[model samples]
Target: MYSSVDTIWTLLGAVLVFFMQAGFAMVETGFTRAKNAGNIIMKNLMDFSLGSLVYWILGFGLMFGATNGGFIGTPDFFVTGDYSSSIPSAALFIFQTVFCATAATIVSGAMAERTKFISYCIYSILLSAIIYPISGHWIWGGGWLSDLGFHDFAGSTAVHMVGGVSAFIGAKILGPRIGKYTKDGKVRAIPGHSLTLGALGVFILWFAWFGFNGGSTVSATGDDVLVSMASIFVTTNLAAAAAAVTTMIITWVRYKKPDVSMTLNGALGGLVAITAGCDAVSPVGAVLIGIISGFLLVASIEFIDKVLKVDDPVGAVGVHGVCGAAGTILTGVFAIDGGLLYGGGFSFLGVQILGVIAVIAWVAVTMTIVFSIINSTIGLRVSREEELAGLDIVEHGLESSYADFMPLISSEAATTTSTNDTNDTIPVKRVNSNPNAKMTKIVVITKQSKFERLKEALDKIGITGITVTQVLGCGMQKGNTEYYRGAPLETNLLPKVKVEIVVCKIPVSTVIDTVKKALYTGNIGDGKIFVYDVENVVKIRTGEEGYDALQDEAEAPSFA
Candidate 1:
């Protein structure tokens, strides 16, 4: 029997892999429009939630049960009846279920922003219940591929390749997202919403990947298992780091700037590439594989985007599908025991190529039929109107992911006045107004990164009446050509923050100085501040005019 320690280790690994669902969601959402964030989150959640149930009902049985004709498994449906007790059945099930879910979630990003939610859910179920498991069985479940000496230590082919290939097919069938291409077949760049969130997701995925490749050992017993686990951890991290550095250097040389989105995806590409041979390759070999994966990711993304004209918002196909297959082949070249470099001949390399080709054929054909069926029925993509407006409101009735960008202001101002009469009697009244205040509107156009600091400066100067809007414009640069997946995108408009502040009592010169100090970044995109003379202002609630309109109650509200 496998030791209890093995079971616990596998279970912990399952938990780590399961947590990757959140990472995938964030990465997908961050790489797409804020309008579709809720939809992305929903898809990630349901793929696991519904996928686990479906996999339990049929997928696990079809994958891990007794082999039938070396094609699929038979029996063990619903995980019932008498089964082998050699290992922990529950642990295996959980680990495999997460893998299946990972494959299902990958396609979501490629087809995001334009797919119908219902159509996506249907495809997700099909991928989990049939598509992924069947291919997975071929390699990992004692099927024909396993008999042919096909090796994928951690599912570079079984999971990443399958999902990536399926994503390519789905994206092709769904067609490019609206505004992705022009009348002359020129591909346009649709930038992601948040690099910070995308970077965070990449980091989380890096953390989870330790479990992904390490836990594939499925045991923590004996010194062999312990040693193999440690090796997997080091190799996995080395490949990812190598790929990140390589991608950064490549982007710097090619684009004259380090592209954050591509760099993050490069890290993932390295992880995927190393997944196939982390157990077999040396640290140097792993680094070599990672460097190749980085270059391959950049090249493949460019080819798929520019040559094939496929609109994959997050470069999912390049990162997963192309890199997955390459990584599997690299295993044959890097494996110490049977590697071609080790004088093991071309046998392992040939088998690796054969397995990759066979699996790709199976997944591509199966997914084509599945997607075709769905396309003819409820449809695969959303309407153009819905796509443009965003899926969050159309599908889930939620606000944009950037809902927090809108600020809420609450402040009060009290005015006091005195009147002198001819009879030497003076009457005083407490009024809410700012009669003598001079109001000026300061419009600061600066980089989004400087907004917070500018706001802090304004607050420090007792000027808090501010409104901010995200606007797109260009200055001397006139925007630049941004290459996405190698396609040149002429972006004439650049993103900037427009901060509108109305100061009644605060010095206009102070506000100007504060904004200038906060936003002077000595760069081309440091932004500009425009000061305007305000003729008048009025408060809606109180019949106050001028500066009074911008003021609020001086004291806090009391419930009593």
Candidate 2:
């Protein structure tokens, strides 16, 4: 029997973790395009469902009962073969289910804006069913690694590290979002749609982590459970505070202003770094862990983006992979009982290192093969045309938003276009075909709600366009109204995005359909769409036109 309070808390924590699906969805969507919002939400939701079922049926036995088998579990699947009742198996399911989801969401951030929901759905099943569980079994199960006296109080190695590696593999296989990398190999800093939402999502995840780390204690018997929960709470907050401050200062010094996204990642990095030792270390130690983790996280994101040429859109690898590994190793050195830093010894560190190495090896090898197979067999990226347009319209055939960018407005005049009423002449940006052109450019103007699906729909067909600008205004209609500050502002023009679909006209209809379907918002504010006919395209390489223009012109939705 268990204490009701413990059970309640555990269940409450599980609920919070479940809500993290929403948090991740918001963060991923905010960081990427609005068109991919539904796709992201779909992926996050399915990830948890698939993760729970798979973890329940397949992962649980391998993780808990197989704790003796040194390599893999021979005991159970469906959690029945060695079913002996000593604990509330349901609680284990709740806690570990969150972990499986966490590992699954890690891939979401890495593969956002481009992955087909179906492909991603299949991968999610594999991740929860096979990838995360097997890696978890190696350390948390009575596997060879656990018997070596490895210590991961939480899941620095088992959950975060494993997820990180999987994320890396998925990202590599998916390639960067269309605009993430340039022809010249320059990394562009693409801003998220909603910084506030992204930041808020991070805070929500931070709050839910109390359940995440605290619920790790499966038994309610030990005072260590309470003590561990308290320690985790204190250290978790401190590390995040330190990380935010560190990242804020670093950004101010380096980039002239504090960046919200980096600060968010820094906070998460701190949490990740301290996760391995939250139970064993003091709050002060947690602060140190966060400070260093913040630095490392920021630095690693840059390194991965530049040196390794990996595109981690949401910094998933840096926050989880690099920091998770760092946290695990630090625990061996900082653990108070016998750490070298506290005059303990190097044995703990060595064990941690071995554990880290084993976890990394397993995840990297497994995910590489899995993703490679998926890519080779089922189609991975959409056709270049579809990519350029957007996945929403292409995959699901529905536009998510109608906000379109007014082509002629200056940056400062962006907000003013709503009031100015003009019906005759729409500000049009034309993109035509050239045999030698290097890229295709198209601007789509429609309702605010429909704008999101156009690009995604286009991308799915066969396009990977570049340099899309999201803006809001109107060309003909006097739309709704808004309250700016205290005064009521009239909403004449609705929102829209200027999709720069850069491709040869080989698959022009793919792009057009996304624009048309999503543009029909069934509202008066549902604005007009203008697809200007391209005139002349120039391919700088060969200075060619017509047939060769398309060969020279480049891809289709996102190019940094």
Predicted structure with the largest TM-score when compared to the true one: 1
Worst 10 residues of 2 by lDDT: 481-490
lDDT of each candidate versus the true structure: 0.87, 0.72
The prediction achieving the highest lDDT against the true structure is 1
- Name the runs in model 1 displaced over 4 angstroms: 81-86, 401-444, 449-470, 475-477, 480-490, 499-534, 537-560
- How far does residue 184 in candidate 2 sit from its true spot (Å)? 1.9
> Candidate 2 versus the native: TM-score?
0.71
Superposition error at 443 for model 1 (Å): 4.2
Kindly report which residue stretches of model 2 are placed more than 4 angstroms away from their true locations once superposed.
81-86, 219-224, 401-560
lDDT string for model 2 (427-481, tens) is 3433333334333345665544565566576656655544556676765556553
Clashing pairs counted in every model: 5, 91
Candidate 2: C-alpha lDDT: 0.72
